[model samples]
Target chain A: MPLMTSLHSEASSMEFPALQAVSTEVERATVDRARAGDQQALADIYDWYMPRVYRYAVARVGNTHEAEDLTEEVFLKLLSAICDFKWRDVPFSSWVFRIAHNCIVTHYRRTAQRGGPTSEIPLDMIDGRHDIAYAIEEQITMEEVRVAAAQLPEAQREVIALRFAVGLSIAETAKALGKREGNVKALQHKAVAKLQKMLIPVDGK
Target chain B: MTEFEQRLSECLEALVQGRLSVDECLEMHPQHADALRPHLIAATAFARTADQQPSAEWATTARQRFLIASGKSLQEAMDIEPEPTFFASARVRFLLAAQKLRQERSTAKPRRVPLFGTPMRAVGALAASVALFVGFSGYTVQSADAALPGDWRYPIKLQTERVRLAVALSADQKRDVQFDIAEERLQEIEALAYKGKIIGPGVLNRFVEQTQPLVEQANDGNLDAGDAARLQQVSIRGTQVLDQVEPQVAAGAETELAQAKVISDTGVTVTRELVVKNPDRPNIVITPQIPVSTATPEPTEAIPTDEPGAETPTPEPTDVPATEDPEATPTEITPGEVPTDSVVMSELPIVEIDDIKLHTLTAGRLTLRAPGPSTGWYLDGVPESGVPLLVTMKTQNQQSFIVLNTQNGDMYWYVSAASNNRFDEIQMRLTRDGQVFQADAAVLRYFYGDAAEIPLLVMNSIRILPEASPTPEPTATLESEPTPPL
Candidate 1:
């Protein structure tokens, strides 16, 4: 199918690498130790997952301060609820992302109660790199994509965030969202199509 | 799924797995290529855009906070002592001794000793209890003495007050203890307000519960001269503290603060009258002059002003007798003339819904705008035991219902579409006396949209009437009928 050849051009330009699946044995051991109240294991889990959680939070909330607060709240909730975590088919990462997802939902609800605006793409997310022109181009693209993504329906937006932003597999996304894998696939397809229609004109320009 | 959707999902997965490019996927399925290209590009762009990294400094600080929080969690799980070094050591020793006794009982021969089988163990348990009591009485109580709301020691302080009240034998003794506790609550409120902390409804409720009885006693002339004098001192102190702290109180707690201010003002008025009746009473010494600027007049003004000689000179808390001639009649200070401060209920405009006037409805000390018959909102009926005045109101579409506790000021707005469980709905702490009310955004946006202002207006129109009344019964029973739609 020449899939590898076609993928290479797009893959080579990819600035943010996709999340690699953690080795099941290693993750299981760490999770088990954490469940046993091992502080080091918990710290290890936090160190490994904090950035991913922060990225997910930023994508969902679109503000650094709120994201930071949500990130901290997620970790604290994990600390309290981890003991009740049963080792099931669901991966630990999915469990952690679920916590982050719920926190974002609550954050949105709270913001709504305050009658405040939700999700403004933070300008500071644009990196100040040596290549000024490239940096500006990259910054503009990200902002445009984020602004478009924010317009997606809540379910579709969440699906795209977990699938593309957090790099969760379709199955993992389903587990985290408490949805069927088929539902996740349908939501992702709809989200991607909507984003395409919204941004295609902008991209052509 | 549509053939195109299936093809897109497959290609998207392959691309996400980093094994297939957008062009390659389209090349493999040329029929779907035109439709797939833009979607693939959008997905890729979003993936790149959403991949955000927090600043290094923030990450470092966040990690530090996470670790600290995790440590505290671990300490709590392990049940580590939060006491001083001495108490911690004593507690550790006590736990160790208990553990040793448990081990000894498990390992030693299974034999009962004397009337109390395991006499040593019983003695150990007794010793532990004694130690706990001693430790609590000595250190915990001393520390809790200064504890404010939200402090870990605050519950202990409340427990100790309950203990003091429980131990008092006579009615007068209990009343005295109640007065002391009431003063303590005022002090806690002052301390919290001074630090710009929120005075929650719980503290305000307790303060009213404690002081209301004593205020009533003085009003009814049931209190002895000594008790009346003490009531006067407390009322004065309460007035001074509330006035000083009024500006410092946080925004949401204003209703509770206003209610408390009314109680204090009422106490001041009632006690001053008692003093007037017994002018020669040794305890009728000087009471601090209330600054007219800070004195709220709602409570006093609400009383009928029909008496010819109602206005009296403000009583100065001095040692001088009330009258120059001991034989001469004392100047009477009528109850109606006592200056008091509260949110004036009369100022609230009468709201008419569907041509039905919503007049002020009084229940105990609480007065609110009674929901009009045609307003869709109904007074579901106050529980026979008059607290929390739960008035359930349904929206026009019957999609949501709000359960408002008009007494303690908790408003629970529930959307039927959200969850069946009421707890999942938006629960807002309305200001006591109904000064400020806010609606949750999710409920408003998802359901009400442009009509969000309807709920806010209804809530704002409701007012808490601050008339001095006896304490309400504690329990509540909700009405059975489901509220109808607006």
Candidate 2:
């Protein structure tokens, strides 16, 4: 109750700003507007971080529809809790990213339980033209990279998303994730190492 | 920095900057990136998915919810752009959820009460789909130059390689197939959890065995579900194990992995580990050393009773010699009291009576026509009203009045004859305490009474002052009507 009461008090004090300042300011504003019952404020908040959220979702779920819905739900969740949001402890984006990650993880668990396809056909498999230049310059190789990433161990893939897609600083991601910064950094190291090994050519070798 | 860290940083920076495209990202760290880039690419792919604007129907459906939360219909809300703030968005999200709940209420018939200790079921895939299509306009794919045809060949080649790698008839290929099968099994366990199926260690072991192959194949670049499924089917003959496992498997793997991470860690432990053990109760041997104590009953005394019916004949009286015994019972009167029958009420003298009608002089403070009624009225118990047989009760200390209105219900309290100095103090006191003053109009019949009690005035304000408080009486005696004046 104290946490909730204190959070509510802080939420009331921090209101949304119309024009953007720094990303931090934008985040504060989003939280404030969400607390104030502005549904559109939620949409705007989603719009700001959705690209990253969507990227993370797709990385884990490997489906556009699922990723999009998951991303939306994450924002919706954040919006719902806006009234009692706090800025003292953790970075807001990290928290939101954590939600997105959790949903993807849940999706994976569900589909695996159902014995659905685990080796997902890359999103490009579902639809072509992910990037026009890739299609023009080198479709075959880029497609291989996409499939290869999917083939990586789930842990490695997670590290990639936390590091690359979410752009979380090691410490922020670690805290958001309840992990040691060292462990997260190690994961990033291994994940990127694995990804690089799997996708590059060894012409000299 | 170590070579790996340095290369990883350069590669990641390039990846984040878009300077190193997916192919380039893969080129830099082929075996690693090829296995991992799919995730980032998948993310990119979903981000690029075409955005479907919410349909009018969806907005209409959400309108009622908006109305309830914001006092604005969905159409109205949508027509106006939302202000940029988290609180607003949160409200919108709640409004949306509320709308969904309302729609569900309208269309669905409720059934199946929740049971205690049961886990919550995941949202149905169909329900999830509806939420997506209705709330968000489906996945939006971007059409940037980086995601076009030039990059199409790589993924196709990868898929083709996977197909070959999965079905390769070699021993290594079979091993790869087994790993794929293992991965499929793990996925099945995951799917089970997702579908809300209960599982145990046996199922978990099977899941691990099934997923092991996939992990191996994943490492070997022999990954592709279609090929894996085909090979698994050919080997197992319609086991449909993969089909049964993948959905929940995906969900399960993520959960199990997350839970495992939460439970334990190598150096730089990731999360706090919690272990719950249900140990068996220990056996105990006991010897009876002392007797158990019992309670003793209490003693009771009883009086003798006799049944009377037939009387016996009297015995003859024999006179023994008259002797003065000191023990003889004495028949002497004790000193101070007189017998109750000797007192007489008939000796009292008669009192004079007068007849005149008196109106209520003031509220709380009652006055009667002095020259008319000699009868004293007792209020509760004490003589108060001037008219004979008048009574007033003080329920609360607040000065309440027994206002006696005339038969026609006129305000008799204001009568000039009833107005005087004695009444003024009573009114002032009653005003201080908030009590309703009323006089029983029926008491007017008592106007003719003896001069001993001329115009009896009852101070309903008896308890109004701290001094006139009634002696505490038994609660049982309080309800009875006071004895009528003789």
> Against the true structure, whose TM-score is highest?
1
Where does candidate 2 chain B have its weakest 10-residue lDDT segment?
B267-276
Predictions in order: chain A TM-score: 0.87, 0.74
lDDT for each residue of candidate 1 in B1-486, tens digit (9 for 90 to 100): 999999988887777666776667878999987777778878887776656677887787666545444443444333345446535333343333333434454456465555555657656754654454232123443466689999876755665565456435468877888888999988898888878886666777678888999998888888987888788788878878888877766677678778888888888777755653464443211111212121212555544444434233122223321222211211232233222222112222244443433433433333344343345454454454545446566645565566765454345655443232222255443443324434443334322343334344344333333344323335432344556788
lDDT of each: 0.62, 0.39
- In every candidate, how many clashes are there? 11, 139
Q: Which CAPRI tier for candidate 1?
A: incorrect
Off by over 4 Å in 2: A1-22, A119-143, B1-4, B14-486
TM-score of structure candidate 2 = 0.32
lDDT of 2 by residue, B1-486 (tens): 666555556555555444555556556676565344433343333222222222344334323222222212221222334445522443344444434433343346565646631123224422442443344321111111112112333222222223333334466555554545444444444555565665433454544444444434433445453443333332232123434443443444545543322221110011000000001112111111222121111112211113122122111222421222222211221111111111111111121222322222221222221111222221234323332223332223222223332111112111111222111111211221223332321122111112112222221111110111233465756578988999
Provide the lDDT at A85 for model 2: 59
